[model samples]
Target: MLPAHRLPHLLSQAVDLQVSRCPYHFEPHPPSFSSQIRYSLLTDHLCPRSEFPSETVHILTAHSDEVWFLVFSHDGSRLASGAKDGEIILWDMKGESPKVQHKMRGQTDGIAHLAWSPDDSLLLSCGREDCPGAIVFNTQSGEVKCRVQNSAEDSLTCGAWSPDGQHFYVGGTRGQFLECALDGSVSSSWEGIRVNALAAHSSPRSVYAADTHCRIRRYNFQDMSYDNLIEEDHSIMSFTVSRSGRNALLNVANQGVHVWDLNDRCLVRRCHGVTQGHYTIHSCYGGLNDSFIASGSEDGNVYVWRSGKEKPALVLRGHSRTVNCVAWNPVYPTTLASASDDGTVRVWGKEKAALRQRQLAAASEPTGITGNGDVSESTSERRGELGGGGVGGLATSASSLASEQLDESLSAASLAEVGSDWQLAVDSLTSSMDSSVGVQPLSLPSLSSRPLPPPSDQLPADEEDEDQVTGSISTEV
Candidate 1:
């Protein structure tokens, strides 16, 4: 007879088999509905499977000071991070271990924001208030392409590249918003209340800017007129729009994270419990198809939340100081990178087979007798060995043992399929489901039969208006 503790695992496997056998039953339903069923079957059970590994796989200690900002290239080939010491490091992600490809010097006052051009040929770095200019660099040579100097009375705080890749926009503390050509010429200038954050959306051909008064304004590129999108009660520090342009994530000071539905023009969810003090911390959309939201916390940890969850799904502890930024790999959905005041960038990802082994080992502790006269003495001995150590020590041992199991199970592709299926379920829940469903269902797919759309076909073209040149200037650095 099978052990009572093994029933859940067997039942889960049986459900997976059923799902695989009649894949057509789910084909007729919307992806979101099918995903909801999958998520419920996988996570809502008494013994749940692990969604992702909660440990850091790689630690990158290349920067000397607090790391502030991280951004991946448009094609997701390289990742760039900025630090408090004004150094920008480019990481090559093709290898097993991330290697520094370029270490370029940025603003002296420290880098505040980074934006990559749509074509990925150029990078824009916005400096802190004390610095008078933003720097544009050539991605290949790491050479300074141009310097955009603000007037003595103005300082840049945020920036974004235009969809057409011809010009970029920069916002300053003095409420100055300017459109500049790649050759360092100011095309147009406008004034607003203090601009704190700027985001460009191509589909609407508009730019979204958050001001100090807790107001978000949309500037239409076609009409050159701007209007208020939404006004909040808290000060807006930073915000990022998802690649799909369906939702926007806002970081309100001391108010946690807010998700806004662009179509409905309403707040969908607010994820709390992430420590956000006076300092500015950035949040981003990542995971599979932007299904999860990740942010750095002042409490020296990275918090990840599913789009539908009101609280954090995972709290990753590795940084010794405040974490400042988190970026997800666009091409590879599983990989995540976080930068911190601890002066290191940590990379995280799911380890399927290893995580399963650890979970199975942890769940194997016998609570009752088996069909035999008594449980084996070896099982009792293993339990005693595990219980003999302190909690931290036991956790370490379990991780080590799981790593060993993973080394042996690496040949099996089923583990990889498990992660892939979960990712697909998440993508379907977030992207296909309408707002009427409230929060996305907390579930995952039982089968890995669904294929992901091609990267090119996944993103729609951003609708933007033609650049309207209003002014010009000459500068060199």
Candidate 2:
């Protein structure tokens, strides 16, 4: 039997194989989700990415210090951002152009994190204030709906919504995880080491919290009991669990991009050491389909990694200061928003224009490969024409093909009637009816079996091996 903790991870991986396709490569585009960039002479900027030079998207500067967090609505139509300035700003991404929709002020000590309801109608913001430190607001009208003060003495580091959207989980100054309802009533609480980062499974049945001691713990919402996950070498500053809930992407002080397999008892499969800068990951979000993971670091760079790949697909650098948080829109897989210590929030979309230019360049390059393997006499000239366009053109075509394949496979399967012989054949191969073996080959109960058996009965070891080999041969055929 599999360990209970590893069961979820295995099941999720099996489901993902049936429902989704992994990306061949992932890359981070320009940073567009933070505030204004300013260089302080106290320390030289240490940025750890080698992928791109510099590209700016939509830069919105309003805050003075660090813009701590960014989160999106369930539909991806709206966004909410929090910062050290103790203010929250909302953005409308569905508009023709991304624009700040509304701004709400609360929490005197500064906003540490923001959590949106599963439906996206209500948003919860937590910070350090004298009395009521936590507040909930309506995203549509910029209205303050409710506030909960003295719930926790310190700043709220992170918060998550329950799977059914009924309970909210908050972690911070209290050294515990509190379960509260929509009305702000505390339902249950689990106390532990001080938590710096937090995440919950998509089902919301379980919660994962990380502390300053470099330890991760899982808490069962039902019993309020917790289990200590394996401790790493560095403190778990920030982490993001995949949408499929099978694995997590974590950033340790010394280890970067730690992929923990939730199905395998949270086993650490691979660690892609991010030495881009000497800092920790502040914020991260997994892709909607769980294909990739994106993270914002104190090094002022955004890193993107394909779900199971060891190396990062792309690194985006533009923020002159450290980035505090990064969020990706659920509706648009390629669109990202971020906030930084420089007091800016920005939005970035894939550069279709730049891709087009690359395609045009490659199509005109010299001939390298064709029906014949040898390079032609005009190879150099042909390469010059094809090199530029080839890469971009290939990307566009591959994406199109992948989309079509996904649509075709995701549709539900249909059951239809078949011939009597086929029915008999299926029954002979699959039926569980008990009957004696017949003398006539055609009349034998084993030859023509409806539904397959439960696979409880075992054939001889040699026969079982033969059957396995034959099954593979038939599938190949």
Candidate 3:
């Protein structure tokens, strides 16, 4: 009885769930091959995310202005970045060093976001209100294909290409929602709510948009109908959809990143530890099989979290200013890229040399890794002190004591396992699974867990929310 559009979306979610592709699922005893891999993420991963992309391999400084957004191509072979100075730099990521494949310039002001077509043949870029021009570029040749300008009265703010690659959906601050073809033609247009972000779904033939008022809604083009997906107390900054199109990650003002189950239409998890007060922070679904989540923080750090948990499993520090965007390589599980207000883009991944150095350091420690693959008093104490105090009261050192964290010998194998297929990794995951026999991912008790407060319909109390960092513009259009 479901519509044709709805059937495709439902099937995709069912397949993704049946395969146990999401490591965040809270099943007690999952019987799928992916379940074994889930435990690998929790147990095989060490503090500081030992095998994760903790080392910065490349630092790109071509932009004279602060970088606003970053996105990896569908093939994961190239990365494109946009900056406040209106330049788009494409980097070839296949080499030992990421070199500038092409430098594109079109807009006069900042570039708010970038999108790569599903075929990887073209790029759609949304500009700030100062310029209000959307440009489509031929990715292979770095040539401008077409340009779509805003109306004299209002400007476009966000865009995303549809699954069929014929046209894209764009939204404006003044509620101009339209479908535009690549040839600089408008296919269809509508008057919708003011939008801050846009994501397109092919299966359901729908578009999901987040407005400045902290509300998310879905618009089905076929039926010309809409439904509410999420409503938060704080203003929404950005939204990232999962590969399966079943989940979304939202970066909100004053609140940290949140994970929402699109199928269930509920806030599943609120990633904590790190905080955000202002500006749009973009987050993504990454890691092997999209089991892990990563987000750029307003505090200049990149946080990585296990999908099921609320607290970040690892915090990466290095950026000197707010890290506005992050992208993980879809092909290479270990590689990650982050853009910052400090006018630089940094690449991170597992480094064998650094792994060797850590191995030597851990080998020399007086209290080294124990037989059970757990770190000794030295490392455990540091984690304990950090996770000691509770939100209100009680202890939460389960992360420190619940599992053995650092074992140098496990680095190479874990990195390989991270990128391995569940079918092929069954043996390795089961072997390491035995070592983590008793170590379980911690969950807060019901007595201590608090339900989300009812959402308020009032505007955000932060008086400067409108002026401080909304799209780097002085005022909303």
RMSD of 1: 18.3
Q: What's the TM-score of each model vs. the native? A: 0.67, 0.60, 0.67
Ordered from best to worst TM-score, the candidate numbers read: 1, 3, 2
As a whole number from 0 to 100, the lDDT of residue 27 in candidate 1 is: 23
Least accurate 10 contiguous residues by lDDT in model 2? 468-477
- Tens digit of lDDT per residue, candidate 2, span 415-476? 11333454443444323221322111223233144433312112211234533311110100
Ranking by lDDT: 3, 1, 2
Q: Report lDDT per candidate.
A: 0.67, 0.56, 0.67
User: Which tens-of-lDDT digit does each residue in 426-460 have in candidate 3?
Assistant: 34543454456434333322312443221221112
C-alpha-based local distance difference test score of model 2:
0.56
The ten-residue window of minimal lDDT in model 3 covers 468-477
Hey, what RMSD does candidate 2 come out at?
20.3
lDDT of 1 by residue, 1-477 (tens): 878758556655655544333211112222433343443442222111123434454556678888999988877889899999999988776644466778899988788999999998999999876666888999999999998885867788789888988888888667778778899788777766578889987844468888888978887655678887767889888999998888989988989789988777789999876789678899998855676788888988787776666656557776778888888877776678888988887776554532333333334434211222221112212224344334443465555544333333322232344564555544443444324223323343443575432222111112112111100011110
Off by over 4 Å in 3: 1-48, 353-477
TM-score of 2: 0.60
Candidate 1, which segments miss by more than 4 Å at Cα?
1-53, 203-205, 352-477
